[model samples]
Target: MGDKIVIDARGSSCPGPIVELAKAYRNSKVGDTLELWATDAGVRADVQAWAQKTKNQIDSITEQEGKIVVVIKILNR
Candidate 1:
């Protein structure tokens, strides 16, 4: 929560948001939180699935101002 990476994916399509998140996460450290803001409805499920595949932890997901915000905690080595 304190140390995090925030990605804005508004107006992006299906895998676009997810792809951006993956790219951002690639350079992140263990235990760091990744906050993704997207307009794509698929982002919620996609991000969650991506986190599972990468062994990351999802803290919460919120919808505000027509945008979906996903908070993820990196748990990989």
Candidate 2:
């Protein structure tokens, strides 16, 4: 995998995080990676659902000092 694209949608809530992710995902290709840092806790579930829907892979989702750090790998598109 190449370097990851970081999406820092920290303060945004609800669809904000997902929207940013979607945009990045749309521009990304298979094998491209993304690192998202969100403050909204709902991002975890949102990312999970998006990943499933898009047929992508969630490499990891960890909490670091209240920040939800999500690592996703584009598996298909």
Best lDDT among the predictions, by candidate number:
2
Report the C-alpha displacement of residue 12, candidate 1, in angstroms: 1.1
lDDT of 1: 0.85
Query: Would you estimate the TM-scores of all the predictions?
Result: 0.89, 0.92
lDDT of 1 at 56: 83
Instruction: Give the poorly placed runs of model 2, Cα more than 4 Å off.
Output: none
Please provide, for model 2 over 1-73, each residue's C-alpha lDDT reduced to its tens digit, 9 standing for 90 to 100.
5668999999997568899998988898888889999999989999999989989999999998999899999
Deviation from truth (RMSD, Å), model 1: 1.8
Error of 2 at 2 (Å): 3.1
Error of 1 at 63 (Å): 0.1
> What is the Å distance of residue 53 in model 1 from its true position?
0.8
